[model samples]
Target: MNSSFGIKHIAQFILFVALQILLVDNLVLFGTGFCFIYVAFLLFLPIGISRMWLLILGFITGFTVDVFYDTIGIHAAASVLLAFLRPLVLNLLTPRDGYDTNDSVNIHVMGWRWFLAYALMLILLHHTAVFFLEKISLQDAWYTLAKILLSTLFTTTVMVILQLLFFSPKRERVDYR
Candidate 1:
């Protein structure tokens, strides 16, 4: 919203879009359709960001992907849901002290295992929701579930890889005051 944050937001969003469109989008592993790293953008936002900002960021990120992939509103819907769920999930996962205003949702802070759990949870939720909704027009339950599960799994793997590859965000250790 402010000038400084505006720059960071644009940079981050562009990086997410680029990584997703240029890097992750091309990757397919063993014919499994493995990767959708763009989902990470929704999950990695700072904690305590306002609801309106979250939605706006979600819409921007999702719409960018939609523009590139021509997937209608599927990415937009899934990204928004993930963004909405992120704060709640982070709150539950964080300790009593809580994260800082500009803290990151990353393995360095959350621990690799917990980060993986968080990433997997968001990715699965987004992919499953989007995939299922998209498939609803033509596919039955089992078929939809299959598509969702496989796509979710593949996308999640790619998202995790990209998260680790780029962000390893530094965590600050604080001595209790």
Candidate 2:
């Protein structure tokens, strides 16, 4: 990353993680769903970032949240998993025209349907990893599933709203080269 981009990402990382730890993490919906907006930091990372760096950053991000949440490794594990899966997910969802390396993963850039689908898949996976790891047993399988679903929905919804309110589409026209 260039100096300016690195600084921008660092600032975003601090902001998202802080908001997650201080606010969203505490706001559990119906005592089950937790809003993990911090994942957006991972989601919005520049396309084609190295997998190794993504994983390392994911772990660090998750570890930071784990420290605040008192759940060691759970967040780290989920974050790493999400990071590992991100490229694969992007590939799977790639349009015939392909994504611009400079483009961000936001509704404005990708369109609402694509953004929703992408965010839903990642959020569900992330939430499932988290709730299941926290539970660590099938004793409350139904409850775990419910928590995963609800949190996934809640997180995805918040992400869409954030994109709508905060992110603007890239203005440069794609060349389709």
Candidate 3:
């Protein structure tokens, strides 16, 4: 990647992580839903990013949150799982025309419907891992399931809003041939 691209991602990493720690962490709805907005950073990465780098970034992002939230390795594990599954998910959602290397997974680039599906799948998996790992008891299966579903909805909604508010729409590239 170019230096500017690397710099941009670094800035994004800091911004997302900081926002998660400072603002989104406390956003719990009805005591069952928790918004983990940091996952948006990993989800919105360039489409053609290497799997190794994606996994590494995911781990770092989640581990940083784990360090702050004192949740041990729950976040790290969930993030890694999300990263590992990301490419597969992209393939599953790939249009017949396929994706541009520079494209990002956002509402503007992929449309709201596609972005919603992508976010919902990844966030659900991430939340499942997180809640299951945090509370490994089948005794409260219903409660845990509710938490996962609610958290996924909350996180996905916040991600969509953030994309609309902060991220610019995809610019059409013109060829002057």
TM-score of each: 0.80, 0.94, 0.95
**Model 2 residue 140 CA deviation in Å:** 0.4
Q: For residues 102-153, what per-residue lDDT tens digits would candidate 2 score against the true structure?
A: 6767787788888888889988999999999999999999999999998999
Top candidate when judged by TM-score against the true structure: 3
What local distance difference test score does each model get? 0.73, 0.87, 0.90
Which 10 consecutive residues of model 2 have the lowest summed lDDT?
168-177
- Model 1 over residues 121-140: C-alpha lDDT tens digits? 77878877776667766548
Off by over 4 Å in 2: 171-177
Question: Which window of ten consecutive residues has the lowest lDDT sum in model 3?
Answer: 168-177
lDDT of 3 by residue, 1-177 (tens): 776777788999999999999998888999999999999899988888889999999999999999999999999999999999999999999988998877777688788889998999999999999999999788899999999999999999889999999888964332212
Task: Name every residue pair that clashes in candidate 3.
Answer: none
- Model 1, stretches more than 4 Å misplaced? 1-5, 30-34, 137-140, 172-177
Model 2 TM-score relative to the real fold = 0.94
Better of 2 and 3 by lDDT: 3
